[model samples]
Target: MAYRRLSNQSLVGVLIVLVGVVLLVDTTGLYDTGFLLTYVPSLFVLVGLYALVSSDFRNVGGPLVLVTVASAWQLVALDVVTVGRILRFWPLLIVLVGLSIALGRVRPSVAEVDDDRFDLVAAFGGLDRRATSKTFTGGNVTVAFGGGELDLRDTLVPAPPARVNVVALFGGVDVVVPRDWNVRLDVLPVFGAAEDDRPRREAEHDGVDLVVTGFCAFGGVTVTN
Candidate 1:
């Protein structure tokens, strides 16, 4: 069965709300912010729960759980490292993004767009989606302080002409459609770029037409074949 579009923001929002609730609980004088150390591991645990519920979260949640364990190991086994120690491991974020890309590839293949409406939003993180749809018409994608990717490389475009509304601020969105599809870009790029990287052909667009209309502020949108 298909699940709701689980973007990075949605997952991060869950973690944030959890942390806020913990802090809110502590505000009753039961414990201080330091007490959060006791429940730090729960952060990744909750993300893990989302992983089990939504396939879209598995790629991100799995690596987050691993990172949490590593962090906990440093905190407990290494006598509580300082914030600088954690920053040193920031490169792992790139590694996790690589893992997310690889993880997305190994997922079981399915028809991605079974619904008429689809929404994807990424904030404070990155989301990679490779999908197929026989009934896909139009949708919306938003990215802020983050990035998102939509790969429709191998999909059936029942709707030849579809529109995708994109909003990127301090972030970017990358799209991959069929090679033969005609791309109409109408995005306002402010201190940013919106480009089509596909090789051009003079042939007519007998396949599908993807009109990308959006706003990019301090960010960009890329369309590739």
Candidate 2:
């Protein structure tokens, strides 16, 4: 009476199998199912929705925009909307981006020390921050058309689990943590990548467990020791 959650690999495998079956059906002239292709754009919408639910709505702006665009694309494909009509509202994208930036610039949840938490944003520029907090908590990072680096190697996460939420759009963000700590990466990449290049620890240590969760669009997020 219990259902096990599907892993990313398992979900991808299922998707591949479904796609193959559809292709086979179409190739063999079983049925005129070409109409299903019109729903391809909806995949992005689904991804955005999944991200929103997974992150508990803490990260919204980027995913919301992605969902909006994908929905528009799907409408166009379904002949419910036209490309010219969508073009007329192109400036709305800029307004949304501005709002996202403004909303993201906020203080962290807790600030026990001067450097316990931080929020960094880099747009059309670069930001380099080094945290030396003895009890590092958590923070947020945003990079759009720029790059950022958060160095926490000198810090100590006395609190077992510290979370960092990141959003990279057409840019990159690098997080450098201690070599002995464990990293739990839960980032979503859309036409982008989020990589952990840190070497595995041969032995386990009772150190901080960093949780990096966010989404990247046409960009990347890298974690290293």
Candidate 1, run of 10 with poorest lDDT: 108-117
lDDT of 2 at 199: 83
Residue range 1-225, candidate 2, lDDT tens digits: 999665433443476588788878988999867888678789767866765564345445676678878888998999998999988888888887777567556623212224777655544445566778888898877666667688888788777688988888888999889877788888999999998888864235554489898889999999998
Model 2, runs deviating above 4 Å: 7-9, 27-31, 107-178, 181-223
The stretch of ten residues in a row with the least summed lDDT in candidate 2 is 105-114
lDDT of 1 by residue, 93-191 (tens): 677667767765877433254454466665445657766666667677767666778887665557667788787879899988887788788788999
TM-score of each: 0.52, 0.50
By TM-score, who's the top model here?
1
- Could you list the CA RMSD of all candidates, in the order they appear? 8.0, 8.8
Pick by lDDT: which candidate is best?
Answer: 2
